[model samples]
Target: MDFHALQQRLRRFANERDWQPYQTPKNLAMAMTVEAAELLEIFQWLTPEQSLNLSDDQRRHLGEELSDVLLYLVQIADHGGVDLDAAVERKLAMNAIKHPPKKS
Candidate 1:
C-alpha cells in the first residue's frame, strides 16, 4: 500500500468533514488507544488458540478495529512530522541491537 497516499486520503476525509480541529495529535493518540482497546475487547474472553483461529466474522471486526488504530497512528505521525517507515526501521535496528540472536 502507498502509505503516504493513504495518509493524504485520511487527511482529506477529515478536511471534508471539518474535523481537523479535533484531529490534533493528542486527540488522535487517544482515539488510537480507544481503537486498540476495542480491538483487545474482541479477544478479551478468547483463549490464545481461539484468538489465533478466529471466525470469519470475528476476523472482519478485528480488521475494522485495527484499521481505526492504524489510521489514527498515521495521523499522529503525520502531524508530528515523523517519517513512519524510517522510524520503524530505526526502532527495529535498535531492538536488534538490544536483543541479539543467541548462538546455536
Candidate 2:
C-alpha cells in the first residue's frame, strides 16, 4: 500500500474533523495499546486451534482491531517523521543478518 498517501489521507481525515489536537503521539500510542488489548482480548480464551479457525464474525472483528492498531501506528510514524518503508527495510535487513538461514 502507498503508506505516504494513506498518512496524508488520515491527516486530512482528522484535520477535517478537528481531531488533530487529540492525535498526539502519546495519545496515539495509548490508543494503539488499547486497540492491541482489544485484539488480544479476542484470543484471550481461545485455544491455538480455535484461534486459527475463526468464524466469519470473529474474522471481521479481528480485521477491525488490526486496522485500528495499524491506523494509529501510521499516524504516530507520520507525526514522528518516520519513513515507514525505509524503517521496515532497515529492520528487515538487520533481522536477516541476525537470523541467517542455516545450511541443510
Candidate 3:
C-alpha cells in the first residue's frame, strides 16, 4: 500500500472541504479514539468464538469501522510529521527486544 499516496489523498480530501484546520493531531486522535470505540462495539456482546465468525454484514460493518480508525490515524500521523512505516519498524524492533520468541 502506498501510504504516501493515501496520505496525499486524505490531504486533498480535507483541503477540498476546508477541514484542515479541524484536522489537528489532537482532534484527529480524539476522532480516531471514537472510531476505535465503535470498532470495539462490534464485538462488545459476542463470545470470543462468535466474534471470530462474523456474518457477512457484520464483517462489512467491521471493515467500515476499521477504515474510519485508519484514516483518522493517518491524518493524525501526517499532522505530526511521523512516517508510519518507520514508526512501525521501530516499534516492532522494540517489541522484539522486549519479548523475544520462545525456543520451541
Candidate 4:
C-alpha cells in the first residue's frame, strides 16, 4: 500500500470535515488505542482456535476496527512528522540486535 498517499488522503478527509483541530497527536494516539481495544474486544472470550477461525461477520467487524486503528496511527505519525515505514525498519533492526536469533 502507498502509505504516503493514504496519509495524504486521511489529511484531506479530516480537513474536509474540519476535524484537523481535534486530530492532535495526543488525541490520535488515544483514538488509536481505543480502536485497538475495540478490535481486541472481538477476541475477548474466544479460545485460541475460535479466534483463529472467526466467522465471516466477525472478520468483517475485525477489519473495520483494524482500519480505524491504522487510520488513527497514520494520523498520529503524520502530525508528528514521523516516517512510519522508516520507523518500522529502524525498530526492526534495533530489535534484531537486541534479540538475535539463537544458533540451532
Number of the predicted model whose TM-score against the real structure is largest: 3
Better of 1 and 2 by TM-score: 1
How do the residues 1-104 of candidate 4 rate in per-residue lDDT, one tens digit apiece?
Answer: 77899999998998899998898899888889999999999999999999999999999999999889998888888899999999999999999999989985
lDDT of 1 by residue, 72-101 (tens): 999999988899999999999999999989
Against the true structure, what is each candidate's TM-score? 0.95, 0.94, 0.96, 0.94
The C-alpha lDDT values of all candidates are 0.92, 0.96, 0.94, 0.92
List the pairs of residues colliding in candidate 2. none
Model 3: number of backbone collisions: 0
Number of clashing pairs per prediction, in order? 0, 0, 0, 0
- Sorted by TM-score (best first), the order is 3, 1, 4, 2
lDDT of 2 at 71: 94
Q: Please, what are the lDDT tens digits per residue for candidate 2 over residues 1-104?
A: 89999999999999999998998899999999999999999999999999999999999999999999999999999998899999999999999999988974
RMSD of 3: 0.8
**In the order shown, what is each candidate's alpha-carbon RMSD?**
1.0, 1.1, 0.8, 1.1
- Stretches > 4 Å off in candidate 3: none
Output the better candidate (1/3) by TM-score.
3
Kindly report which residue stretches of model 1 are placed more than 4 angstroms away from their true locations once superposed: none
Mind giving the per-residue lDDT tens digits that candidate 3 earns over 1-104? 77889999999999999998898899998999999999999999999999999999999999999999999988888899999999999999999999989985
